[model samples]
Target chain A: MLERSHIQSTGFRNVGPVGERTGFELRLRQANYRGTRLSLIEGVTITVDGVLYPAAHNLVRIGSRVYTPAELDAATETRLAVGEYMTVIVPRPGGLAPGVHWVESAIGYRHPYFPPAHQSAVARDARHATIVMA
Target chain B: MTGFRYGVSLYSYTDDLGTVMTLDDAFDHVADTGATGLEILGETSVPLYPEPPAAWLDHWFAQLERYQLEPTNFACWVDTRIQLDRKLTVAEGAEQIALDLRLAHRLGFKFIRPKFGVIDYNLTPDPIWEGAVERNLDLAQALGIIILPEIHAPTPIHHPVTEGYIAFIERTGTRNFGLMLDTGIFQDRPLTAWGGGDIEAIRKDAPDMVNGIKVPVEHLDDIIRYVPFIQAKFHHVDEDLHDHQIPWERIVPRLKALGYAGYLSSEYEGVRDPWVAIEQVRRQHALIRRLEAEWEAQHA
Candidate 1:
């Protein structure tokens, strides 16, 4: 079972070689009530310790495959199911000091039913998660 | 007296499902409520939806038999706007309906509620809904399923969207199609906690929905004949068995008076804390059943 909160602590770690980290990645349980196709998901934005990582710089990894924001717009058949989790990769040169940090995630989901301007309704979640490894 | 069929939609336990609850747990709760029907969203409830594994299929029937419950409605969606840039072609939309109808039939469901993509804040469905549904009418009849599009909150019954649906039924004269009324329209109070979506955006987009649409219960008299199922959409129900948002008191009696014997499937959209929905749904069942019994006893 996934954590109750949308932002999960299980997969929170730095990517690339441990000491020379390229960035950090955090797992987020599917934000919508129902499974949504990848294209329907606009992008995922992350903020850690008040430092913002916009959607444009984040690459979403669902299962083993990773997708860019533009790729998500074209990947119509690929769906992110409920109970499933996606990883948001944020590029930070030094990652973070090994400790607990306040983190937040916002998934911009475009519902076809919603009018044009409000299509991307943000499902936002914030929590403090521990990064055991530096 | 014909009584309303009791049921619970798995929607009540949306956030809880993967966190603290499972499909088996949901069945136990619904059965303990003495609900005879079980409703589920096709995409959310079925693993690897559209093509659930064979083993899961077997487990599904097993659960139904063990719980002594019947499948009532399979909720689905038509992403009319399938992508960020383009809309679903008519063929793609029809295939979507056909796929859901077959799956609903296979799962022993009597109704398939297709939530079509809307074009506006009023929830006016995309134009493709008509052509797509029209193409699938024969298949629905053969499968013994009713295709329902919900008259949800932010959209009243007398509006053009609903009138357009009624007009489609009249023009096509199809028994396979009808309206599914969500009780949220009758909600007269403000919601303190909304689990369904981003609350601030909803407040900005549809204030009427946030405050309450308060569709007069009497309007049920006009459309009761076309409505075959109801999503008892509610927010909060306290220990005293009082719903804070939806007006079930007025809604139930009118349904009873209209002789509506369809399913009142609970859709509890409220505070999303774990295990909250489980208790909330129980309170709703208790609240509605008491109201129903009161109505029946008064008439008797």
Candidate 2:
């Protein structure tokens, strides 16, 4: 019966190679609803250093952590140095489906959409951003 | 009518693979029940976690041809624990994605069925949940596959993955990403809780039920375009009455109207009896085939 549960944690690490690739992890319980298995939360989004991950890829890892939106690392946020930790959380191991005691972790892998050599690279603006069901 | 083939998802026989049947045996069983297709769950057909040798690829394909069964799609995964909590790196996860995609391609499957965020009792994404999904999808696209996020219950259609997908496409503009619609979300009632009520009673009682979960019935016009494949998610079957609450009559027609000639695999998730449940899956497939014919007749 628990579809969307919230989770919070601190002192998570930025595991990415660069500060841009770091992420976090969270753990939570699973619940069932109406013959259907449900998880605590949905998907996690990552922002390395300061750059918000345009998509969920290189974003959150499912199953390793306990809750959704789990895992936050420095690499996922704006230009941060290595060893700088961030926060993250995902629903559970089953991906929003009930019946388990698994955790979900999200890690941010710094995106160099701009080549490393391009020192004065201006981060290309996201064409458009939205939050709608596909 | 294209005959609109029917199939049984391999997930049902998760526990007893040796006793129930091999992938080929299951396909044979489906054909015996007069079904034409087969839906392979990744766990049963593919190798386990940690990974398996690439040689297994040919073995699976051989099974598909020997059975004369068309692979509907793959039920791949990226849940909370494996992705979020485990020490596995995103690059490692990408490798898994690539491996699964190759498996799907080798088996002639067009889509991958993966569920959304993991199930934490707390019900929420990891603090950095969004980043993980984005990276997974990125790797999925590289493999020339589509990441079809399943819309199952508890994590209704209104969830972030459902919405984030829209954002993903808009940002990346890739057709390789879409929704894998599961019919169970449309049910109007809670059949049972975790092991307390009568499973059989609920299955029988909700023959025409609809939980009215957030599946976006009203947004079909908008959502249908995003759906590349659909799962005829069924639990039990009434071989005598020839009915189930999955709403195939309503859904099949709508799918056909949208020219959705993709996979319509059957997912049986009841605990009554695994073997009997499989037969019910075949029966359900037969019913779907008949409905497909009728709809085609009217349209043609």
Candidate 3:
């Protein structure tokens, strides 16, 4: 099982004090609990408040590899080593008079045992972050 | 000798994980019921799994020593879909399994319940599950941990997945892999007081939700050897210590007749009210103890 843990909004900074644009990074560790490595070819999805942002669309930095939307979509299958973790940075766009916000992220992919065209299932984790728009 | 050993799953008191009860409290509760074994849900019980620090591991073992509890199973997940876009390769899946195996071994557990990725809500195995299991068979043997796929409710023992698992075991001749039969399947009816929904709606849905696709009690004989433990899944226990849904009277004796020696871990997947759940577990243990004595006498 690829378990998602330690999900937190690490750093938040304001682009403008009037809240023209807000930026934050959601830091999480995706740990592979299965006896094997996994690939993130399908891309990840991050939902802030109720807005859905695909990893392919957002900038994601794992290790030293920074993936653009087009690159994440076109990247080959890179396996995540078992028991090893990939620290993921999901760049979030923010516009808020915020007291608290909820973030949910999930990666949807088919199991190797699943047949072709079968609906993929998701490994999901969520966290609540109290944000102060200072 | 009676073929069954009694135990309680810490999952029964999950409502108290970080609140009312700590892991120490859970061990005390299990010991109070005269159960020597404990089944721990790795995700909830272990704080930072696969890499918990030495201090945490020491505390875990200390609790076990204090309560004289044996770790029976470390229930975990095998997520093939950790990535958003692609499935893990066979080797990758094996790596995840090996990781859990190492953790389970380190924690002194002999059994690991790995929930393989499912295709349906009923937890139908993905077609490649055999390959996943096959790939890890060696590691499982080396780690000395048996991987038991939970045959939970709504998924009958006769389901194609169960059959496939049985075939896989036969084909591979591996002793490190087995089945963990959940007693939820023997539930003959739906729970009346299950976390208040529309009583009528629950009543209608309960049958299909709990017992609709159960493995018949008779089928237990055919698969008894493969089963190392039974998750005695219960929702409610009455004043008389009787479960309204599962037919324990019939099932317990059958297990004895088959000479099945395994832990019957009380897995209370009921409401989150801890005190009531504790009482319910106590009553369930009473029922199991009574049945064990009765069955032993009859056979003797």
Candidate 4:
């Protein structure tokens, strides 16, 4: 079975003052438990209050490389090794209210064993605290 | 009839990681279920690997004593080729295994379930696994810990790797090495929670792929003696306390007949919500208890 474990979101806070574009950082570790190197077609998606944010955004940073949606989606080969961790960072800008908000992130990929079928791994962080003016 | 004991692995509560239940909460849940044993992932459950703070160790033992739970298996990672660029040397791999063994010993766990670096989706052990494990046999014996490579799903019980492991044990006569049989191998049907609606439809849709791998129930008799621990791997348990996927009815009785007394640690890998998963674990323990009693009565 393909597995991803130890997924978490860290360094989440209000990026700017109350009336400005607000966002938080998402950090997650993705490992390929499926023996062979599996291609990670699209990195991940962050959902905030029912809104979907793809990992292809220009603000998304996976390791040292930053990519826009088109660039991340267009890149042909991104294979993850059996035990290697691919730390991901997603920067979302805009419309984050004060107090608590629900945040969820998911990664979708294809493995060779199950050809033509996509597998998705998801992690959610509830009680993400935000300050009105910090 | 074998006196089988029920336990809960912290991995069962994976869905609630750092959100709903902390490690302490998992202990309370296991204790509440009257499970006498507990298993934990070394990297995830332990605060620090190779070395935990004195205070954390104190609190850990206190919880174990307070809840009266025995430590069973310390799940560890044997990463030999996880590196994206290069593979670690045999020494490096052996070192990782030894470190975990020492940690397991210090934590009072006699068994360790190590996930070796696999070479295929079928979980064939990496070629270096044999050498690495061979190097650490002495350390394992000295530490009084048994290293059990998990024979999990999609990897058949009769696979070459499994045969090789059994051969290694026979050749070396090392009691420190054995297998941890995951119940996923006995899954009879595709999990409805994972595969929507019709199991056949899902199988048909994914023609070349398998939903669950099934090993003949009777075949377990051949290997049960080599297995000291069993991962009661379940994807879903219905409201009626029946697991529709795995053939627990047949498998449990087979183990009982073999007099296979080992820890059946609940490992719920369902797609259900966290709270539901917790309840499913409790249900699994109840089912195990019921089956054990039934087996005892029939045999007597």
Best candidate (score: DockQ): 1
Query: Global lDDT of each model?
Result: 0.92, 0.48, 0.69, 0.68
Q: Compose the digit string of candidate 1's lDDT tens values, residues B1-300.
A: 899999999999988888889989999998998999999999898888889899999999999999999999999999888777899988999999999999999999999999888888789898999999999999999999999999998899999999999999999999999999999999999988888887787887778878998999999999999999999999999989999988888999999999999999999999988989888989999999999999999999
Point out the worst 10-residue segment of candidate 4 chain B by lDDT.
Answer: B194-203
lDDT of 4 by residue, A1-134 (tens): 11233344344445544556556554444332222222233456777677776766525455476555455544433333322344444455664555655666565443322212222332333334333433
Residue lDDT tens for model 3, B126-227 = 555677778888988988889998887667888877887888899999999999998887877766555322244434434455443545798998888899
Clashes of 1: 0
Arranged by lDDT with the best first, the candidates are 1, 3, 4, 2
**Worst window of 10 by summed lDDT in candidate 3 chain B:** B195-204
Please give, for residues A1-134, the per-residue lDDT of candidate 1 as tens digits: 99989999899998878889889999999978888889999889999999999999999999899999999989987888888899999999978778999999999998887766577788999999988888
Among all windows of 10 consecutive residues in model 3 chain A, the one with the lowest summed lDDT is A31-40
Query: Where is model 1 more than 4 Å wrong at Cα?
Result: none
DockQ order of candidates, top first: 1, 4, 3, 2
Candidate 2: clashing residue pairs, number: 142
Candidates in descending TM-score order: 1, 4, 3, 2
After superposition, candidate 4 runs with Cα above 4 Å error: A1-134, B194-210
Q: Write the per-residue lDDT of candidate 2 for residues B1-300, one digit (tens) a residue.
A: 444445666665432243334556666676565655677765445543224366766676676677677777777544334322343345554555566677676667767765333334213333333454556565566666776766555445666656766776778777777877777776553443212123443344332222325354544556777877777776545756344445666766776776777666676665533366566666777777777888888888
Maximum-lDDT candidate:
1
Whole-model alpha-carbon lDDT for candidate 1: 0.92
